[model samples]
Structure formats: C-alpha cells, structure tokens
Target: MTLPGLLSATVAEAIELVGDVRAVRRTLETLVDLGLGYLTLGEDTPALSGGEAQRLKLAGQMGRTQRDAVFVFDEPSVGLHPLDVRTLVHVLDRLVDNGATVLVIEHDLDLIANADWVIDMGPGGGAAGGRLVARGTPEQIAADDDSLTGGHLRRHLGG
Candidate 1:
C-alpha cells in the first residue's frame, strides 16, 4: 500500500486531526487515481519528477469545495503515458463540472481534444511565437486554415 493509503487505512481513526476521515480518504483516492499509488508520504520531495510534482499539486486541489474559480496548469501532461492522460483529463473535467474555469497550457492533443474551448498560441516558438493563432472548439480549430496548430490538430484527430 502507498504511504498515504496506509496511513488513511490504518491510523485514520487515531489521527483525528483535521477534517473528516472520509475527506482524508477521498484525498488519498485522488492521489492513487493520478497514478501516485506507489508513493510513500515519507518519500523525498526532490526525488519526484516534474510531472509527479505537478500531479501531486493537482491532487491537493481535487478535494477542495471551491467553485467558480480559475485554475491554471502549464503542460500538466509532461510525463504522463498515453493511458494516464485520460485520468488527468477526467480530473480537469471534474474541476469544470464543479464550476471552475480551467485554463491549461498544454500541447497534448488528447487533452486539448477534451477541451470545450481552446486558445492556441504560437505561429512559431521563442521570440516569434506570442500571437493568438486560433481560438475555438477542437473541431473548429482543426478546420481553420491560418492556424499552424490547426494543421497539426487536424491530423491528430485523424481528419
């Protein structure tokens, strides 16, 4: 069992520290769902990869009761396998369903495909890439002619 999972399972009743046991368990489940089931609470923070840290930060937000808030993520899919991307998207979707506005700066086609609205920037990278190249639903962006992102997105969707 994961360190957090073990703690929640074995010493939950004794902890009685803050929040309800159910809330703590829910948080643990969210961590496991984000592909962090193998992590131990005592694990060294510096040992985690960038993607693991990002997902761990996201896990902290999953159980919050906040609504109508805006959450921003930058390349949250960095180290995720293709299969794991779906879980990340699901978590983002849950945030939206709970009335949060999620703005993800992501290059992952699968994650972008799940978005309700997309704003694609970058006619080029570096000093040449700050312009808004496209803004619309995934299908609309895929169909746009002037957007470079559109061209790639079209192929990504098998269009």
Candidate 2:
C-alpha cells in the first residue's frame, strides 16, 4: 500500500488490522510517549520518519496470515536509535518464533547480532563484493577472516 494510505488509517484501525489493535495501539502510544515524535497522517500518503516506516512495515508483516513464506527485508533497521533497535530485534525474533523465515540485509551490527544465521557478503562493496564471505552465527562470523562485519561485531561484543 501507499505510504499515505498506510498513514491515513486511524491508530486504532492500523493496530486492529495487524497483530492486535489493542496491542498495536499500546505499542504505538508507547513510542509516541517516549518522544519518538508525532505521526502525521496526510491525504495521499503520510510523511514517515525512516524508523516509523520500518516499524509500520514490520507490523503489517506480523499481521499477515501467510505462513512459511520467505520474507526478505533490506536494511530494516534504517532509522532507529539503539533502543529502538532492540525493539525491532524483538519484533523480528517474534516472527522467527512464529515460524517465519526472515532474510534481512542490514548494516546495523546490533540487529545482525540477533540473527539465527547471517550471510555476510563482502570482501569489498561492488561487483567484487557480492560474494558471500561469511555465514554462521554472530559468534562464528565475528571470527571469520573474510568478514568485515566480523570486526565490527567483535568490537561490539567486546571480543
């Protein structure tokens, strides 16, 4: 759906459609209360902060009836602060817990750290980089010689 259309739905309607209305409202209100900022609903498509967009997308997915489908998400953590990153991770974990296979392409080390398995593509960034240089748990990947993500995660994990 269009961004504006997504935004135009009342907080209640949006919540009800995906997951649970009551639960979603509680979640959204908590974010707003925490000063994440206002969510403006516009005529065509509402303007959304990057974090807001990501959260909405996730919520929609959570509400879906489809099962056993591979869900590929590109940089799903794009606009969140560290705390929100944790929240996003929890949401994703819930999806995995519910039996969904999630493939996420992201640079955020924290989110990457939570993956059941990670496929890190690089040695470099372009044509030379599309190759898979690493694949494993966050711990295993952190020890891989060819993984750039390994170093970043190692530092983050204090290894």
Candidate 3:
C-alpha cells in the first residue's frame, strides 16, 4: 500500500510533515543554496538544471564528515549572486579548514581572490591554451604580467 499523494508532496508540504523542525530548516537552507527553494519535492529530478544537480550533490557532500578528501567543482558561481558566492566560499573554506582539498574551476574574481592558492591557466583558451600561466596567492596572480587572469584580477582589485 502506498500513499501516492503523500509520497508526491511538494518540498514545502513534506517539510510540514517532518517531525524535526531543525532538520527541515537545514534542508531548506541547502535547497536555497542550490537555487531550488522554489521547487517542490513533487518536481521531477530530471527537471533540474546541470548546475542545480551539481549543487544538490554538493549540498549532500557538505553534510558528510570527510577528511583528507579532494573535492572538485566547476564554476560553482555560475548562477549565484555576489552574496550567494560569499556563502558558497564560506562553505568551501570550511571544507578546506577541515582537511579537504577543494579545487574549483571558476572565472569569478571574487571566488579567486578568496582562495588560499590559485593556479591560473592559459595564455589563451581553446587551441591556444593549456599552459600554466601563473600559480600563487591572489596578490601574486594579480601582479603577474604573463597572466591574463592576473590582468583582470588586478583591474578588479584596483591595483
């Protein structure tokens, strides 16, 4: 016997049915981070965008207790606002502090600036790229004339 209606309830509706208020609240926060706050549990998983799916996976990983792990992310800031980027950075920073190695492939200067280390790639993209242009802290990257990323970072930082 199955309660199809109950099983198909929206996230908001299902949260109402959960006994643990804190857990529901935490789940809501995670959903918000994934930009899925507007979604209902009734929404099919296949309807999610690639970024949404990635974030959902990241959210699940965030709850795990993993040490000495390597986490890689691609453009996590793709759909996030500046404030949301800050939140995402905070989470990544926490993971790093907790002994996880986070390697993010991003073009967002804000995220780059907050990183402990950066490996700037490419003298150019596509057929002209795959070279390591620079590697250092944000300050060093910003000062490296060989790095296009550094030029942009320098401008962004008003250096």
Candidate 4:
C-alpha cells in the first residue's frame, strides 16, 4: 500500500520470521535514526530525498544475511551531496567485502574511481553508443586513450 505501511509490514514480517525481535528492533531503530537526517517516511511511499531513498534501499539489502546474490544498482548516487556520496561508497564497499557482486550503472566519477572493477559503456550516449569502451581498475581506465571515461577520470584526478 503506502511506503511507511510497506516498510512497517516488511519489518514486522522480518522480525517474526527471524524470531529475534531484539535484533530486528535494533536494526529498525538504526535505519530510522539514519533516515532522520535525510528521509521522511510518509504514509505512502516515503517522501525520500533521492539520496535517502537510495541509502534506505541499500541498507535493507545489506541487512540481509544472504551471501551469494548478484546485486545491481542503477545510479545509486543520484541525489546525494558529495559528502553523502562518500558515505554511500563506503556502504557499497562493505557490501562487496561481505561477498556480493555489485553492478552499478552510474555517472559519478568519484564513485567510479573507487570501484574494484569498472565497465564503461560508450563511444557516445545513445544509438551511437552501447559498446564497452573501457573495463578495468580506475587507474587503467584513467590511463586509457580509447575511453571517454578515461579523459573525465583523468581530469578529476588532475592527471
């Protein structure tokens, strides 16, 4: 139904399923605390600022105990201020460290620079694009002449 309602229901179900109300309550409290700064859980689909929504979704996924699923995120940094972007990056890194393959489609160079593996699609943005222009560590991408991503990345790094 509504966002808050959905979140509440999901949280309740999770608590019941896990049979650990204390742990679930603690986790929910942590999420709410985090949300207090950037999100407003509304009656229907919380009126989340872009970054808050992204972070909340990510937190929910990270809270899962599953270890072998492929997680895909599209522009996870869409509305974050630079500071929040850094926080989001750290969260992603933690997820990777915990044994998950994260595939993210993003245009934020800073975040891309920290990725373990980056697959850049280009030559151009639309009908003129769709091929892999570069794929490597941030350094390799920065040094490659064939990649548009390299130029922007190099500039950002002042290389």
How many residue pairs collide in each prediction?
0, 5, 1, 1
Candidate 1 per-residue C-alpha lDDT over 1-159 given as tens digits, one digit per residue, 9 for 90 to 100: 444654554222323333456876677677767867656655677988877888888888886874978888888888788877998888888899998999998889999889999998888899989999989999999999988888888999999
lDDT of 2 by residue, 70-130 (tens): 7777776766677867867776777787788888889999988888898898888887788
Candidate 4 residue-wise lDDT, 34-71, digit = tens? 33233323324466555556666666675675478777
Q: Can you write out model 3's per-residue Cα lDDT over 1-159, one digit (the tens) per residue?
A: 135774576555665565477976678667665555556666777987665667777877766775988988888787777787787788788788888999999999999999899999899899888989999999999999999999999998999
- The residue ranges of model 3 lying beyond 4 angstroms of the native Cα positions read 1-20, 33-38
Candidate 1's displacement at residue 105, Å, is 0.3
* Model 4 residue 15 distance off true place after TM-score fit, in angstroms: 19
Against the reference, the lDDT scores of all candidates come to 0.80, 0.70, 0.79, 0.71
Better of 1 and 4 by lDDT: 1
| Comparison by lDDT, 3 against 4, better one | 3
Error of 2 at 80 (Å): 0.8
Error of 3 at 68 (Å): 1.2
Report the C-alpha displacement of residue 118, candidate 3, in angstroms.
0.8
Pairs of colliding residues, candidate 2:
4-44, 4-45, 4-46, 15-21, 16-21
